[model samples]
Every structure is written in C-alpha cells, then in structure tokens.
Target: MSLPDIKEALNEYEFKWKAEQVTIQATLLKEHSDGRVTGDITITTQAKEYHPHIHQSQFNFSAGRTRETLAKTLHSRVPDLISLKQWEDIIEQLCVKIVAMIREGEPALELAIDDTKNIPPEYLLEPILLKGLPTIIYGEKGANKSTLSILFSICMLLPWKDNPLGLVCPTRSIKSLILDWEQDKEIVQYQAKCLKDGMNLPYFDVYYRHCARPLANDLPQIARNISKVGAEVIIIDSLGAACGGELNKPGPALDFFAALRELRIASIILAQTSKDTESKKKTVFGSTYFTYYARSVFELVKADEIDKTSSDIALFNREANYSARHDPIGFHLTYNGTGIMVQRQDVNIGQFIKRHSTQQAIYEVLKRGAMKPKEIAKETGENENAVRVALSRMKAAGKIVMTDQGYGLLSKDIMQ
Candidate 1:
C-alpha cells in the first residue's frame, strides 16, 4: 500500500482497538523536528495474555521512518491490533461501539437535597419572555406582531431609564439580534433609525440580519454570528418563513425548535394566525408543537372598542409557563417618519370594555332622555338583567341618577 494508505490504516486500527479494552489506547502525539514520531502506546488490560509492565509506553521513532516501519513497530508492541477493511465497516463498527458504551451504564436519578434554591427566571420582558427560554408572538395579518417584536428588541437594546413596556426587565440594556425574513433593507434601516431617535439613544446594540435561508440550513451560521456578536436575545420574525418546511408536520416543527434550543439564546418567534377560521386554534397558525415547545406565548388582536383604522392593538398573555398570566396590554402603532412606532397605551382597556359595556350602553341611551330599564335595554340591545346591574353600578358611581321616569345622567356630571 502507499504511505498515505498505510497511515490511514494505522489510524483506523488505533481507534477501533481502543474500544475493545478498558484502558488501552494508541495516540500519535506529535512529529519532532528531526523526523521522529513521538506518541503513547498504553495498555490497561490486566490480562496475562499481553506483556506485563507495558502500562503507558512511549514510542519515539528515529528520523526518516516510513509508514510501513511505524505500522510494524505498533503491531509488534500492541497485541491483537485489528486490520482495516472497507471504510463502511469501520464506520459501522465505530457506531456500534459508541452505542454499546452509551448503554453500558444507567444514570443516577437522585438529586442532592443540600443544593441551593433553584434560580429564579431572568426576564428580558417580565412575564412575557424569560432569559433562556423561547417565546412566540402570534396574531392575524396586520395585527402588528412584527412591530411589537421590533419594539421589544429595541427596548432590550436601548438603555432606558424606565421599562418601555411598563413591564420589568432584569437588565437595563441587552445585546439583541433580529433575523428578519419578512422586511427588506429599507424597512429595517428605517426601523433602526426610528428606535434610535425615539429612544434618544446615541447608539443601540441591536443587530439585524435580513435572512433568506431556512432555519434548518442557516442555524449553525446564525449561531456563529450570534456568538461572534455576543447577542443575548434573538428574534426570528414570522416563524413560517424561517422554517422552510411544512410547519404543520411534526418532524419539521420539532426540528426547528430543537435547533433553537441548541442555540442557547433567548428567542422571540413571530407567527401568524390561521387564515381559515374553522382551523384556527387558541395557539398559533400551524401545528400545536409551536405552542407545546414555547416557554411563553402571546397573542395580538385588534382592540374591540378601538377602530381598526385607528392603529390600536391589544396584547394578551395567552400562555406563560413561568408566571401567572398578565392582563391584556394595549398599544397604538403609528409611523414616526422613521418606521412603525409602538406606543404603549392603557392596559386596562380590555377590562374596562368588558366591565363597562352595559353601563356605557345605558349611559348612551339615557343621554337621549330618561328611559325605563326595558326601554334602555331595547334601545341598547342589551339584556334587561344586564341593564339593571349596570344601572345599579352607574347610580352608585354618581354618573347617573334614578329619576321619576327611569334613569338619566346626573345633572352635575352631565354636559361636562
């Protein structure tokens, strides 16, 4: 055989032979300047069939030693050195050895009782995202999911005195990376300018990549980039575009998230709600695996009382595994000449609309004139019982009064 072939054969034999014994190994450490090979030929087996006192013997070859000479030297000293066959067989045997070793011992299941308390979750956005876990934000088209995600990224990147979302963050400023598959260069440039100007920060630490590759193919490269930049947070805009495979299938979904887990960076994945009304779930647009693997899930929807054209949005904490679900938060999206801007609005809007719907209906009807509960209910299209309950609450609040006819706004409070 040629010198290169002989060297390959010797290397293959070393690896395969080591696996059969408990502590036997042959390693080529280095080549000396004068053409001598220096390495260890160790034998740990206590078997009497092998030579005694050959525990960890070092072999230093003289200058100009050929591969055949090295192989002969190794074969003479090491007992039962296997010969290399086809490359496929070598690979197959290596795989088998690995599996056998892995299955050789059972793992311990007990935990140490003396260990300290478990670490509390570190929040990038408290109650919404934990530092080491994955978070997903889902909404229908035009629900501002991407805008909200961008806003969150900016908040994490900026050194704000107060929490931008009115939520808690463990750190004031975080290095963030946004892998946007949806937006173009112009849009992202505009967004960066907006965040920088709006926050009045001279500089921001967030990084952006307008990604075109699928998660499966690009995860390794993405991970290297993140590590190179030392990013603490990453956002994958619109999970569908990044997945590159049928998300409804379990294999691809699991694979995508598995890749994310391996990345070890806190992630925020944007997703869409199913266009088909009949197929829509409380979770995201695709397979349930998206929600199953996510640490937290949030949903964005159009505000009920707010007009769609008004650019109002409501954010709901659909799922939060680490903490209790938070109340719905509201936001107003508007372009501030740089990019789409997210302004936090009243968080109590959802609750207020639900709790005061009947009362507001009654108040509007009573503005015309005093009317009985049945008449008010008819005019407002609310249940009579609901109208009565609302009237009682409204009267107690001094916003309305019980008159001889029915109910009317308190004079002092009216026309104000």
Candidate 2:
C-alpha cells in the first residue's frame, strides 16, 4: 500500500501507516530556524511468538538523511522488521512527500464574511472571553486575576447556566486546560481545591500543565495534552513567563500569540501589570503588540488588600474588537470558610473609573433621582471636578440635561 495520509494538526503534520502489530509513524512536521524541515519518526514491530521492539528519532526531510536513518532501523532478522531495503524505501518515500508538502506550505482558505450572511461574533464565555479567539485579563500582583479566572473556568467547565457569576455559557460543558508558567501545579492545585470547595462543586476537573518554555517551543506536547484531556478552552496563567523572551520586544510577543492561535482554541490569558502600574496608568506588562494582537482586553483592579474573606474588584474594558466597550463590571468575591460567592456589586468600591463610562455610571445613579455634581461625585467616588467635566460632556453630547434639581439624562432608557 502507499504511505499513510498526512494530517495537519495545527502547525504540524502527522502521518502514520499501520498493519496489525507492524506500524510506522511520523509527527511534528515543521521547519527549524535554519530553514530545515524536520520532525520525529517512529517504528514499531511485533510478530507472532516474537519479541516486540520500537525505535524513534528525529528525521530531517531530505533523501540523504532519510536513507541513513532508515538503513539500520529494521532488518530481516527481527520478525516484522521490514528488510533493510524496504525500510530505506519507505523512509525515502516519506521524505520526498514531506519535502514537497513543506515547500507548498499550509493550505489557505478563501476569506469571506459577506454582509448578506451577517454572521455575528461568537463567544466561549459571553462578555468575557470570545470563542476561538484570544482575550486577556491583566492586573497588578495580588489582584486575584488568576483566582477570578478559576471562578470563570468552573462556570465554563461545568458550564453552569444562569450561574451567579452573571457570565453566560454554552449549554454544553467545555473542557479547560491551565498552562501555568508563573506558579507550579501545587499552588494551582490548592487554589483549585479552595475554589471548588468554596463554590460547593462536587467535582472540578479542568486539566493543568506546568510550563517553563515559550508556548511555541512546547506546542507538540501541549497539543498532545490538549487532545488527551479534551480541552476546548485554555487558561494561560499570566503572560510574562509564557513569553519566554524579551517581554518588551515584538518578536516574542508575536511568537507567543502565534503559538496560541496555532493551538486553535478559545484562550483566556492572565497577565501582570508593570511594577509601577499602580502609580501610573496600568497596561499589560509586555510589548504593545500584546495589546494589538489581542481581540479583547480587560484591566482588573482590586480595591484593597484581602483581610480574610472579601475583596472588591473592577474590570475595565481596555479594548474590544468585536463589540462595544462594556460598562465597567464590578464583583465582590466573598470567601467564607466553607464556600466562595461572587456577586455583582457597584464598581464604585474604591477610587477608580467605574462602569460603562463615568457618564453611564452617573446616569444609572441619576436614574434614581437627579443629584448635584457633588452628590454624584460622592456616589461614584470621582473627584467633583471630574464628575462635573463628565456631566458637562454629557450635556454637550445631548446625553444629559441640567435641571433645577441637579442633572438628568435626556432619555430615561439609556440602554435603548
């Protein structure tokens, strides 16, 4: 029979030919930095009443190297080990096919998003993570971004509908994998256990993989694990360590995302802000390309230190590609001794920008009653001047009207 069919899995090609106990396989078909097409090959043999043997090694996609690697790999003496000549011939055939395949490059599909069809954007996690795209949640140290992700992951893994997190999930459960570079499995394990217990879940079994290398360098193994665990959603535990290169450089940033895209699954990547972010405006602590490449980004801000049980947090949409920037959503995570509860709270916990826009926050509060600028400022924790400026802008934009009472929206149903 002819050589086995080559199948593309992400950025690699996998090929295998088998007949009963005699089998041969090839995988990881991709190029190296020096422009050589290389991959791993394996040969396995077992025969009736004879010993079974296996041999595996890296193979270069060239006739000369294939011939050398194949010659001594199998011989007539070992039952089912094809004759030397036959082995060489099979590898040679594989080399020729792979060389041609590599030169031709990954197949491309024609692009079309015709307006007539009008396909809407899809989400793996509504309003938080997009389906089959990359989204980020970045914050300073101790902000509990990772823990927040774990809470979301449980919602998706069990995929609880109408869950308390207020995040929507598909009817079907999606498996999740966490690739941790910042923390080891033990820490993650403890965190997972606590969350599971706190959430009162009977079971929480999302997969976890410890990572130290750049994602691209670990694609093969990660892909294998993804397949093994049936992971559809991946949570990258922070970006700095995963980058595995100069965090400030575009090359590392681009490569890291390219690797994620190659995995071809929905991803929620956790990231850290620069050390001085609290004193300055917070941005993801990496190349600007990180921001550019991401489909959506959220800046998570924690209000204060966690004393024992509760912490207030706010999520500000820094960028969104597919939809309108969301109103700031705030949450209060209460970790009681037995369980954890995440509830929607006013984002106005501490001194930071709160929901929709400051204007929307003001309008929401104003819907209760018209309040003066100082009252609005007091309600939102915004300095009086900033609230007045927002109010003035809202008036100029025809969004708000000044009245004897204080300030009011021109339209009551701003949501409309």
Off by over 4 Å in 2: 1-29, 32-34, 41-91, 103-117, 278-280, 353-416
lDDT (Cα) of model 1: 0.65
User: What would the per-residue lDDT of candidate 2 be over residues 1-416, giving only the tens digit for each residue?
Assistant: 44665666655655555543455566666665677788777766555655654677877776485566566655544635456666666667677777787778668999876768776788878899888899999987888888888878888888788776677887888888999988887877778788777767768675799988878778888998999999888899879888888898888998888788778888899998766633536788878999999999998888864587888888888899999988778888888876667777766634454323567568777766778999999987767998999999988988788789999766655443
Model 1 agreement with the true structure over 1-416: per-residue lDDT tens digits: 11111122222113423333323344433344464444554544344576443345554433233334444543455536333322223333433343343234346798777779887788877666798799988887777676677677766666453754676655567877889899976776666677567555566555788899877657656876887878888889879988878878887788788668767889999998765654323468778899989988887776553443347777777778878776667776665554444667865432334323466556656767899999987887678998888888888888888889988987754553
**lDDT of the candidates, in the order given:** 0.65, 0.77
